[model samples]
Target: MTPEQVMNIAYQGMRVTLLLGGPLLITALATGLLVSLFQAATQINEMTLSFIPKILAVFAVLVLTGPWLLKLITNYTIELFSNIPAMIT
Candidate 1:
């Protein structure tokens, strides 16, 4: 394959990865920030308190977005595999 084709494939793979992971990561980040602010305000410096909320929030996010995430990854994988013959020499 040409360099351009390789770059295109890599870029698409990265885009798919980001799309698949972005929601969970963003949910975790937001949950962590909120938990931190709450801890600061309440002076509840317990480690488990912070950990539990983030875990719950991430789980909720996964539950809510699981179907869409699965569909996205499935579509990407199908597309990539379908294009393999074209990508080959």
Candidate 2:
């Protein structure tokens, strides 16, 4: 494969990875921020306080977006596999 083809594949892989992970990461970040704010307001300095909320938020996002995420990855895999023969020669 040419350098350009390799780069394209790598770029696509990264894009897909980001797309798949972005939601969970963002959800965690938002949940953490909200929990921190709540802790500050209530004077609760427990580090573990944020953990459960972040986990629950991320889990909720994963559950809500699971089907779309699955379809996205499946489509990308199918496309990549379909292009393998072309990439080989």
Residue 26 Cα positional deviation in candidate 2, in Å, after optimal superposition? 0.3
Error of 2 at 7 (Å): 1.0
- lDDT tens per residue, model 1, 1-89: 89999999899899989998999999989998999999999999988887888889999999999999999989999999998998896
Predictions: Cα RMSD each: 0.9, 0.8
Predicted structure 2: clash tally: 0
Query: Best-fitting candidate, measured by lDDT?
Result: 2
lDDT assessment of candidate 2:
0.95
**Each candidate's TM vs. the true structure?**
0.94, 0.95
lDDT of 2 by residue, 1-66 (tens): 899999999999999999999999999999999999999899999999999999899999999999
In terms of lDDT, the poorest run of 10 residues in model 2 is: 51-60
- For all candidates in order, the CA lDDT equals 0.92, 0.95
- Top candidate (TM-score): 2
